[model samples]
Target: MAAAMTRMLQLLLITTLIHVARGKVRVQITNMIGYKDDMNITCQSSDDDLGQHVLSYGQSMEWKFKPNFSKTTLFHCNARWCDVMRRIDFGAYEYMKDHYGCGSDCRWMFTIDGVYAYDSKTDSWDFRFSWYS
Candidate 1:
């Protein structure tokens, strides 16, 4: 029957798509400002709003999601501390670049000097950028 054949095809397509779904990625941001300073962070993608969070020294906030199938997923963030004088507005995650270096777990740390990214291979934090403004 044609109807039965179409249903079979639909089930096959659904199964194939499920097997190819992208893996989830975890992103974490930490505050290492020291001296008991608290950092306020806000992060979002074009499609998502992660809301605002305040992280005290040595505290961290994290989230997990799957990258867009189009490979264009991106999340940007703004951080302010020290009475909002020292601040950083930067790209927190980009699928193309970060996926290779970080695989599934991406970690970033904020400090007085700048940002540090976690290198999973070496189990170390690598300096990424310095404060520009």
Candidate 2:
């Protein structure tokens, strides 16, 4: 019985170490909407709701989390500004795609043109997509 317990403890310790080594992923979204507009934002995953926020120009909202072990983690956000009638829904992070693209620090910028994502490998921002009407 003691031998079995020791083996179990070893497995538990290894699992914990692995998780720690992987660390948490950091995501940040900033308002670059200009013209002094306050952007209304809401973000969530299937398992979590980050609630709503109002970000002024140059302001940012950030969060950190570890990717789901099954590799299916995803988070999306909705943004509204300027015209209250207009809103943009966007994919904030997807483990399968972002893990390799943005690395640990996933930064996003929103502007009148569209959404931009930071690419760690190149140390630059890439235009992701335009606002969908």
Candidate 3:
């Protein structure tokens, strides 16, 4: 009986460790227009409104969401100024590789004209940018 109890405790501990090891996706958004433009930003998933913020030039905000295992979650950001608006979108796996069971912390950044997704395993930033029309 003592041996059986020990086995059960081991199984429980392993299960708990697995659950705690899972990490969520985190994104940081910044307005890098150098004080010339103020941006209104909104981030949302299909079923949830992640957050909204107004960033003056050189300001930033951060948002986080848990991994959705049943299906891919699409998160999108919209940035607006005056009459012009720009948008960017990402799938859960694209933003967080761990969403698909690969083991790495997902950290990403979105700026007014670009993005920088950090690869924890490689310790590198995948950066991209474009002019806002």
Candidate 4:
């Protein structure tokens, strides 16, 4: 009985530790990856994943992409992180009509791998589509 109790306590502690290890990350909408690139929307920490997630945006000081249509930063998390997790970017994102046609509003969709914690409401890009905060 004591052993089972100890195991339960251990599991709880480990879970708490994972959350504790997290840092405050702000997610913003833009065209570029990091801070400021060519086309950018804005930066802030809000409720859900940035847009409808039409575009999967993530910036690591390490990886880089080209042509620079628009770079956007989604969020900052632990060294090990992923957005649109189980949902594969190439695998799942392809099925949905991720890209929304644009003339001037540069609106798109994207994904985040994990749960995001925020108090504000998610941004609704359109009546039917919404962006993760």
Score each candidate by Cα lDDT. Answer: 0.89, 0.88, 0.61, 0.28
Q: Which lDDT tens digits does candidate 2 get at residues 19-114? A: 756869999999997867889999999998999999999999999998877879899999888767558888898989988878789999998887
Winner on lDDT (1 vs 3):
1
1-133: candidate 3 lDDT, tens digit per residue: 9999999999998886666446556666666655677777777877788676888877877766664554365667666664455555444234343454323344545554565666666777777544442
Per-model TM against the reference:
0.82, 0.81, 0.58, 0.22
lDDT minimum window of 10 residues, candidate 4: 88-97
Each model's backbone clash number: 0, 0, 0, 21
lDDT of 2: 0.88
Q: Let me know the TM-score candidate 3 reaches against the reference structure.
A: 0.58
Clashes in model 3: which pairs? Answer: none
TM-score of 4: 0.22
lDDT minimum window of 10 residues, candidate 2: 82-91
Which lDDT tens digits does candidate 1 get at residues 35-62?
Answer: 6889999999999999999999999999
Backbone clashes (count) for model 4:
21
For candidate 1, give the lDDT.
Answer: 0.89
Better of 1 and 2 by TM-score: 1
The model with the greatest lDDT is 1
Model 2: residue 15 alpha-carbon error in angstroms: 7.1
User: 25-108 in candidate 4: lDDT tens per residue?
Assistant: 222332222232222222212222222322224531221111111213222212111333223121111101222222112222
**Rank order by lDDT, top first?**
1, 2, 3, 4
